[model samples]
Target: MSVNAQPCPGPQPDALVRVDEGAIWRADGKPFDPLQVAHTRHALSAHPLLQLPRLRRLALSLAGTSHVKYALPNRKAGSAFHTFSESEAKMSIASTFDHIEEAGNWVALYFLEDEPEYGALLRDTLDGMKAQIEPRDPGMHGYSLFMFIASPPTVTPFHIDRENNFNVQVMGRKHLRVWQAHDRVAVPDAAIEDYFVHDTLRSLHYHEELDARALDFDIGPGEGVYIPSTAGHYVTTEEGAWALPGGRVSVSLAMTYFTTQTARRARVHLLNAFLRDRFAAAPMPPGKSGLVDHLKQPLAKILIESRMRLYGQAAPRGMSGH
Candidate 1:
């Protein structure tokens, strides 16, 4: 079967996003919503565990499990997508937010593990949302909930994520700018290869002109955006928009789904990456042949596993950031 390419018109929607006949349409008049977008953004801040005091304590307590990133807004003009400058002041995780806020900088804490206090709530929220959207088989999909706390006026930078994400804006407001996943002009093919195979940085090279092709949304408290896997996007907080009376904070949850399709795509990319990076062979486009994917997957797995084993043997005993 031969596939013909056609030029499609831009989106023209009144709502940021609209669902009709089980299809979600974007502002640009594109039928782009595949992950089933549904969000109740308002109730996020009201969650008992997300309050500043509680979250601060949680950040401090889960010291080892969490990763803190300091945003350097001035570095945006540079080639690097995100540059993190170490905090000059020695502050604890609990005090990091305050320090960042005071310095007119922003710090983001990523909580990957599900804590006992809020794990159930996160699970329930995701479960409820999943019920309203697509019918996903539990066995075929994996779930993870990441809660982020960022200071005001910080830019998260342009990047593509591996998993389908439900970006729940619980507190504060943000400008979410998303570009089409398969748009080669926005996200380069090599970047996609590096992302899947090497687990390299997901940051994309931002271009001012590409903004014209993007779908921009100003999401406030009680709103959510469905970000499909490999869709390049950047998020920046609105200054003091979501701040409470005392201080500034933007709280959000990134609920991710790793489906069977995700795995297959990863494998396909990994195989292509292996061929291109190792043998200097031109990479083939995905979804062309099932037999090719089936053959490439096991070879990719073996190569990856062998690399891991070799690296494990060569590394020093105590170093452990895998």
Candidate 2:
């Protein structure tokens, strides 16, 4: 991983490109039939429970939604929260979108995909345009062998995902500036296993890399970008200009898949957790240290399955958002 070797430098995209592009939805290229893309999206998003159908809408809602979903008890160690209020000072803003704010300004809303404004747009677009989305940018993500699940437009800043995601831009666009899982980028697992002692793995950022190339894609509405598990990246929305209707309320989706890459990342983290738990409960003896480390891989699978069971919506609430 030559990530930390020399700071790749040019002009970063975020600073240069701000306002939304003109003729945003009216993109020229046709990698996939826009109509097809919309049909697929409509079929998948027909589920009423899905908060956000169009990726862009979902991301915005995540940003704008004031109501906090209950957090799993086993969620991140720091469980600080704020009481929902229209008149309250910006309390969670600093923590909620802290990762994204490192790059630019942010605002979140709580609108479901079924909402009239967003859902109607999504349904109309899907029904009209025969759009096809490029699943994952294979150039960046040849490591995994799996199909993507969803694509969402998110102002992401230094975070990991539950599964491997190759985010594709359908109508509007957002950019992805990725960091490798090596020393140059802030490695969460190392910090978690050693200093932090947090079992649930989360992302950390080392904004040391300033190269424009490091953060690729000065993309517009109708573009696609790829990402792998443990591959760190940041996102920011570029609103449309003054005349051309709405800003780049990017229409994107999370093309999720259970890939080999995700499995590897998961396995490694699970192994680390198992080792940490074992050591914390009872320190290993000199002769048993080798045996304990060797058993970590198989033991890791057991640990991952147990944790997944804790997160289903049907399951009882384990952690509170407040």
Candidate 3:
């Protein structure tokens, strides 16, 4: 709780996460696919480093960095993903955490691994699952962490992410609904292509009808869910749960990574979008044609490298030249 807390100490014996044995498989007992929704438990809620005081310090430390985002809470589940701006906050970044319960704020701390202590935590947590996750989706990279702290009655707008996510609930309760990554009805190929090509979420809109098709989870402290790459999902924190003081605060952590398969799919999407625009070619969606995907990977890589050189910018996350 001390504002002068030092950096996270080197690895301690106590584990930050503890996944139950046999908790990573599918309902039919098939081998885990990094793309499927799964449930698991964690010990993070009890970890000293995740206690509010330490987290407050972490939030304070990220005040001026691009790694932190602050926004007013969205109460509507069907709200547009971009309707809320991260830069528009009702409170100062330094004091937001101190008044989290009443601030009605939604704060996200991204890529925490950029901090030394958090990086070690991410590595140790993921290393423990290498045997379970790597066999299914190998060559994992782009390791990142997203910590979300919000006031009650907040909704995380429906959207898709490029990396596979292990969203663990550390405090309060959350009702999460996730549509399958390949469900075209929930998310069309054109929208996905636009996201990969232009980095836009304009095409991803949530409708009430999509809720019936979602895989839902109501999680609390120590509980977590796995969401696949590009899966469309949203979250709503419960109001008046009576778990914490004032029943007004909720916290969760998303541990995400990119795999070899995800990287390949991104390249394929890039090529498909190009073909669709340039030649009016109705290219198949990613993973639909293995041969075509193999052919496009190299071409996409060339294009990405050329663009980076032209603009003097690094390739975006999840689109690294893998």
Best by lDDT: 3
Error of 3 at 233 (Å): 0.3
TM-score of 1: 0.73
**How do the residues 1-322 of candidate 3 rate in per-residue lDDT, one tens digit apiece?**
0011111122233454443333223323455677777765655666666767889988887777778776545457667664322355445566777678763567888889889887877777776667778887898788898899887778888899988898877776677888988898998887888898888988887899988888887777667778898899998876755464435778889988888899999888887888899999888888877898888888988878887899876766687746
TM-score for all models, in order of appearance: 0.73, 0.43, 0.87
Q: Can you write out model 1's per-residue Cα lDDT over 204-309, one digit (the tens) per residue?
A: 5787888888777676555667787778888777666545442366677786666555566666676687788779987765556787877776776665567669
Ranking by TM-score: 3, 1, 2
Ranking by lDDT: 3, 1, 2
Q: Give the backbone clash total of model 2.
A: 38
lDDT of each: 0.58, 0.35, 0.75
Give lDDT tens digits, candidate 2, residues 1-322: 1111111121222332222122112122334321121111112222222222333334434443443221111111122221242225343433433343232233333223335544443334333332232232121121111111111222444454433443544333344555443423345455433322243333343444443325455543334444444455555454332122323234345544343333433454545655657775333321235466445545655555566576532211111110
Clashes of each: 7, 38, 0
TM-score of 2: 0.43
> Which sections of candidate 2 miss by over 4 Å?
1-155, 181-184, 191-203, 210-213, 238-248, 276-295, 304-322
